[model samples]
Target chain A: MKTYIAKRLLGAIPTLIFISMIVFVVIQLPPGDIVTSPLDRMQSQGVELSSEAIQNLRAQYNLDQPLPLQYLSWITNFVTGDMGYSYLFNRPVNELVGERIGYTLLITLSALLFTWAVAIPAGVYSAVRQYSLGDYALTTVMLVGLATPSFLLALIVMYFGYEWFGISIGGLFSPEYRDAPWSLARAGDFLSHLWIPMVVVGLGGTASTMRILRANLLDELNKPYVITARAKGVKPLKLLVKYPLRIAINPFISTIGFLLPTLISGEAIVSIVLNLPTTGPALVQALINQDMYLAGSFLMLLTILTIVGMLISDLLLAWADPRIRYE
Target chain B: MSELKSQDAIESDNILQVRNLAVEFHTETGRTKALQGVSFDVPRGQVTAIIGESGSGKSVTASAIMRLIQPPGRVTAGSIDFAPSGSEPYDVLALVDKDSRLEQLRGDHISMVFQEPMTALAPVYTVGNQVAEAILCHREVSKKVAWDEAANMLQRVGIDDLQRRMQQYPFEFSGGMRQRVVIAMALVCQPDLLICDEPTTALDVTIQAEILTLIRQLKGELNNSVLFITHDIGVVAQLADHVVVMQGGRVLEAGTVRQVLKQPMHPYSKGLMAAIPGLAPKGQRLATVASVVGATDITTAYPLTRLADGRQISLSPSQLKAFGHE
Candidate 1:
């Protein structure tokens, strides 16, 4: 097991490097550097703009360097404290991400935990009591949840919040603790409003996960081993948990690899609709502005998480399933 | 047209009495009457083999005894009066779903071993943990004690190196060995009635003989009644004290093994008996155990005779089914 983990870790190095390059190239794909848009804006607004100033701006951002050198420089500076300085925010790229990454983690992680905790039991119940009233109701509700896009749900929810409560349902707080530092009151305020975005982001995931689990568990419940366990006098709940659920949750656990990048990036459209201050919005802005290091670093973070998440899930599967031997 | 034995024929010491056991499978296609009015007695400390071909509802009958039949397949009508030796008789069919009484009855008063060892045990768990879990479910013992008892049971089943073998998963063991572990688990609780559902049909001949011998030995040691379900006449010959021949979910004839094997009264029973190779069709298989095993392998490997064999030139679909190919 240790060797297997070590081998996986070693193999991920090249994949991370490869992903890093793709993120860099893709972020760099749009013609012109960060100066292009600003220069255009300044020119169109009938303001005086200088060629030497443009040359200095280009030199400052290393736009004149070769692509590989630029990549190396960006990566190196990123390894240090620089991160190619975000001109839009007038802050370092790392600091910008660090500020918003907390909210991003909080929203996604909470939603993830909530989704699994609810999905598994709901799915198990649906399968165990298949074709019953409760099963049908849950199936119908989850189908609706799956079919409606999260942004639309968020919009409807926001509208309902405004109409019913006479208050805006946007952002992480009630505007009083917008820039407040860590404190019990601020934390409470944030949490009081946490559920909306979490629900909006999590509904689709929860619905899909529940359906998968239900199908997997349904297939496993018919397996001969379940009958053997039943023959052993194992009660319904214990038997389901012990025999079929253990095998059924394989696909769910394997989804960890897919979740890290997705959740960390945040749901872009949903975040926009809910007006949550998460890194998801910043990612798109950074790429569009050609904030090379900022965008590349964000991608790098996702890339690292994705590969590491895969490793963790693979190890977990190897541990849980005796049949899946890593060696 | 010989019929199933009447209730009067059931010995007083019978461990389980099943009557009018009718199972139905409700599917999208339609409802299938898998078993209808299947009556039998599992005499105490004796092996009663219910023999039939595939889809003969023999397995359905065994599962119905434990009420282990899954959804889509249910025991729609039946009364299995289980009167374990030294215990009061109870109407098994009266127990509702998830009833504690039924739970206690399983693994304590009754247990079951299945046909294929390949899928009989959960793959994730160690054999020892599984057996120990079975013990723990019914017994009021500590984990240590349950595990120790599991090890002892494995040893009892002729498995040497019990400590090592118990820690291993099902995939690590051969089919016969896994079956041994399964038997060990079933007998570990020392249930009065143990259902063996085609237990040796999936095994090779030598392993089959060994497993049969082991089952008999364990049955002797445990002194529990066994309901052996199988299709092989040779297997029934070696293990059964009483024989019940079934076709199309109904028992055609049943009696003491001696009486039924010597003089089958029903025409279907006679045909089944004739299929035993040396009694009739020789080279076509079923004469010897090896021939029977080979024949089953052939049918399993090739459903249609794409083989340019002259023997199958005149074969019809019904004739093919008579050979049990479909």
Candidate 2:
């Protein structure tokens, strides 16, 4: 098992390197350089730097170099822990990400947890009671959840939240606790305000998971083994959970490979509406202004997370099912 | 003619009695009567084999005994009276609303081995766990005791290396070995009535022989009555003391194995006998089942094709003499 995991991790290095190249090219795809974009924003703010100084800034940031050479330098520096500057925020790219990373990680994890908790049981119920009134009701609700725009939902929720309860409808904490240091009270306040974004983001994912699980489980329930188990006199509930369910959950587990990486920058628009200080907005801003190192680093992290998530889920699947063989 | 019967005549000394059992399948096309007034009996501590071709209600009879028939197919009429050892006879069909009572009987007092033995064992669970689960489901025993019995059952089924083999998954075992595991699972609870639903049909000849021998040995040791469901007349001959032959959801003839095989009364039963390959003479074309039975409107699919020369496809007198037919 250790050897299999080691081989998997080793294999992932090349995959991440390939993804980094794609992330670099794609981040650079939009027309406009870091210097020109920041220069345009600065002019809009009624503060302008001369064109010579602009050219000087490009030279300083190595924007004057060829793309390949620049990528090479950026990658080397990144490997050595020197994530470059972001002219958009006038701060170090690493610092900008660092400030919001904690909140982003917390919310995304919570949202994912909520999604699985709600979706798996709902799917099982829907499948077991397929075509029943309850199944149809759940199907309609899931369709609505999937089709609704999350940003619009977030806006409506935020408006109702403030109007109804006088609770602060945006951000991770109340005004006084926003800048507070680590404390149980502050943690409690954070949680109190955390659920809004979690729900708004998790709702669509919950619907998607329900659909996948319901379909997979329905297919599994019809297999001969289910009948065999039933004939063994296994009770209805235990039979459903143990025999077919164990196999049905494989597809859902494989989804974990793609799910974790998306968490880093998912819900960008929803986060914007809720005014949550998360890296979702930062990654979007970095891509827009061509903040190459910041955007590349975030994208690289997403790629690494994808590789890591796939490895973890593969190991989990192997553990859950003895049929899977790494060798 | 001595086996002339209705529901009540089948009750005495029988471990299982199915009386006018009717199952209908309701689908979008329409309701089709799958089992029409099907009645049979399994005598105590003996193998009573139900033989029929596909869709002849052979499997439905097994399912009805265990009450495992699913939706769209329901037993609309019947009283399956099960007189399990040490218990009074009760209507098996009446336990439909009493799932707890049925659960107590199924896999505990009555267990079954299905045709697809590889698919019968749950893929993810260990062979030992799958077997032990049957014991634990109906008995109030510790995990260790249940597993010990499970291992013993496997040993009785002739599987060697109990410890390591118990830990292995279904895919790790061969088809014959898997069937043994399936049998071990069914018998671990020491059920009063064992249902074999074409258990050897999926196996190759040598493996099938091995499985048949194993079942005979195990059934004698446990002293359990078996409702052996199969289409193979050869298999019925090997194991059954009595036999019931069915066609088109109705019983054509049922009596002792000697009476049914040697003196088959119905045209369908006679056709089934003639269809067995080795009984026909060499260098003479064997009659297709449709021609042998004089295929009825309901059984048209049995006709392989029509031959212009009926005399060319006739069975020889010597083979007919061996089969105890005129």
Candidate 3:
């Protein structure tokens, strides 16, 4: 297992390098550079800037270098932990991302837990009691949850949280706890406001997850081995779990590669509506304003997460199923 | 005919007595009777083979006895009285809660070997785990004890390499080996009655003969009754002590294998026996059940046949006299 992980980690180097190049090229694709956008904004603000000043700004930002040279320097600095300066935020990209990544992970992880906790059982139940009343009802509700746009759900949840419950549901913390240092009370406040975006984001995933699991499990429920288990006098629930459910969960584990990127860059629209401080909104803002270093860094982090996620999923699948071997 | 056999004899000699068994399947279109008034006796320490063509309720009878008929298919009517060794006879259909008493009966008193051995064992589990699970499901034994018994059972079923083979999954084994594992699982608990639903049907012809021999050898040593379901008359000739012939969910003829084979009373049974491939000369049109048994009557004459060598022969009057019928 250790050797497999080592091999996978080594293999990810080329993939990460390739993704970094794509991220750079995509960030550079919007017809204007970081210097051009902000300088144009400055000119529109009636600030008098000479051509030499523009040239100096371009040189300072390394925009005057050849594309490959700029990529080499940017990648080298990124590899060495220097994420470059974000002209829009007027701060280093590292510091800008560091402040929000924790909160983003906290929400995403909890929402993921919520998704599996709810989806797996619901999926199993729906499959076991397929065509029953509870199955029909659960399917209807999950379908509605899937169809309703997450941002719209977030707005509705926020409205209800404020109107009915009299709780401020927007953002990660209350007014008092927004800038307060870490404390139990502040943590409690943070949790109190985390559920809005968590549910809004998690519900959609839960719906799809339940459907996939239900379909997979339904296929397995009647397989010969399941009947063999049943004939062995295994209790119904035990038989379901040990035989069919074990096989049914394979697809779920295989999908974990996509979850890592989702963890860092959560539902952007939902985050924007809920006013939560997460990497999703930061990445979106950087992209819109063409903040090259910040946007490029965020995309690179997502790319790395995807690779790491795939590795983790492969390891997990190998662990869960004996048939899956990595040699 | 079963009524003529004294109840006392059946009570003492039979492990399972299925009487007036009826099963129905309710699908979207309408209801279909899968088994109707089907009855048979699996005498103790003997193989009772239910012979029928496909859809003849042979498997349904086995499933009904095991209480394995699921939704849309139900035991609509019947009394399946199973009298396992040293246990009081009880009506299997009378068990109200399918989970409690029925659970104890299955894999404990009565175990089943299904038709498709390739798919019968769970692929995700090791051969030992699946076999041991049968022991553990009934008896409250330590995992080690159950596993050891599983290994022993696997060895008994002709599987070698106790350490390596037990740990291997079903996919690693060939079809014949997997069926052996399945048999080991069913017999691990020393079930009084092993319901084999075409256990050898999915295997190759050579493997099928070996499995049949294994089943008989095990039955003799273990002193357990086997309720074997199959459409193969050849298999019946090899293994069965008593034979029950069925057609369209109803029993047509049932008697000792010698009686059923030598002097089949039912035209359907005659038709079935005549339909055996090798019975007809090579290159001749095989006699199907419909051909021997008239569409609306049982009095159809047995046809004369031209042999592969171009010679023709018919059942002589003396041969018909030996059958004691025209």
DockQ score of each predicted structure, in the order shown: 0.68, 0.60, 0.65
- Per-candidate TM equals 0.89, 0.92, 0.92
Q: Model 2: how far is B161 from its true place, Å?
A: 1.6
Clashing pairs in 3: none
What TM-score would chain B receive for each of the candidates shown? 0.83, 0.88, 0.88
Every candidate's lDDT: 0.80, 0.80, 0.83
Lowest-sum lDDT 10-residue window in model 3 chain A = A259-268
- Best of the candidates, lDDT: 3
Docking class of 2: medium
iRMS values in order, in angstroms? 0.8, 1.2, 1.0
lDDT by residue (B232-286, candidate 3, tens digit) is 8888998888888877787766778987787775677888889999787899899
Q: After superposition, how far is residue A253 of candidate 3 from its true place, in Å?
A: 1.0
Off by over 4 Å in 3: A1-3, A260-266, B1-10, B298-326
Model 3: per-residue Cα lDDT at residue B123: 72
Weakest 10 consecutive residues, lDDT, candidate 2 chain B? B304-313
Per-residue lDDT tens digits for candidate 3, residues A231-256, read: 88988778888999999998788888
Error of 3 at A50 (Å): 3.7
Which regions of candidate 2 deviate over 4 angstroms?
Answer: A38-54, A261-265, B1-10, B297-326
lDDT of 2 by residue, A1-327 (tens): 778778778988898788878888898888877877657879999997987898899899887889899889888888888888877788887888788777777887798888899899999999998889988898889889889988889988988898998876888889999888979999899888889989988887888899889999989996877877777778888989898788888877777887876544556778887888987788887887787778887777667766888998888887787887523
